[model samples]
Target: MKIVNFVGYSGSGKTTLIEKLIPIFCAQGLRVAAIKNAHHNFDMDKPGKDSYRYRRAGASQVIVRNADRWAMFSETPQGAPHLSELIAHLDPADLIVVEGFKSEDSDALRLEVFREIGRGEPPICQSDESICAVVSDKAREAFSALPVLDISSPEKVAAWITEKLQIKGIEKC
Candidate 1:
């Protein structure tokens, strides 16, 4: 599967851009998967739930299932796993859009979502050579030949990605 990672600072519109792009890809019938790297501790299950109880009882991994969908929770005592390790658990897909994990090493195309929030912080792309492009609210003149794309237009962004990755949908969604 083709993979792309979107990285940026807080409030840089990374999530918002991804939210817009998913539907465009879906309309073309491509199977898309997303992975988000959370910086804080999070819980998907609540107390008193069977799956939560089972996990509390020390099950290394717990899977809660129903006809519509299923979710698996693994206890990561060793801390968070790498991107590739997490990807291994995913079902097959034509494309995977990863959110965050900016500094992690991967073969996936890294696109930095940049918005001048006036924080006075520079873009990560300046130092991260892995970043292939920049999607920004600003124009191409803002970047120094790093392939700046219009952030307001997700359709163009999606088209650029499909072209770069050579991705095509075989079926209609």
Candidate 2:
């Protein structure tokens, strides 16, 4: 499966872009899967619930499924597994848009878009060579060797991703 990561500051519109692009990819008859990384503590199963109680007691992983939704809960007692290990659970898709995992070195094609003026350039991906493009709103000059994309059109961004991954987009007639 082809993996593309979108890296940027908090308000740099990563999620928004992904939201717009997902439908576009689906329209092209390509299966799309996305993974987002959150920094703070997150709780999928709410407190005071059966699953929550089980997890709180001492369960490493808990999965509860219903007619409508299927969810899994996992706590890393040892440590977090690497990206590829986690991604293995996902079904095969044409593309996987990863929101974070910037620190993890997976064979994902990285697209590091930045704000360029205020926040300055993002730290170079030192430990990983997965960065295939450095997209920016204005810092294109500094990263002269990388491909730059406008922050406006999700189509352009999606097109770039599809092109890079050798995935074809259905033409809109």
Off by over 4 Å in 1: 140-142, 171-173
Q: After superposition on all CA atoms, what RMSD does each candidate show versus the true structure?
A: 1.6, 2.4
Lowest summed lDDT window (length 10), candidate 2 = 120-129
Candidate 1, run of 10 with poorest lDDT: 137-146
Pick by TM-score: which candidate is best?
1
Give the distance in Å from residue 148's predicted Cα in candidate 1 to where it truly belongs: 1.0
Q: How does each model score on TM-score?
A: 0.94, 0.87
Each model's lDDT: 0.91, 0.78
Which whole-number lDDT from 0 to 100 does residue 111 have in model 2?
86
Model 1, clash count? 0
Evaluate residue 17 in candidate 1 and report its C-alpha lDDT on the 0 to 100 scale: 98
Best-fitting candidate, scored by lDDT: 1
Clashes of each: 0, 0
Model 2 vs truth, CA RMSD: 2.4
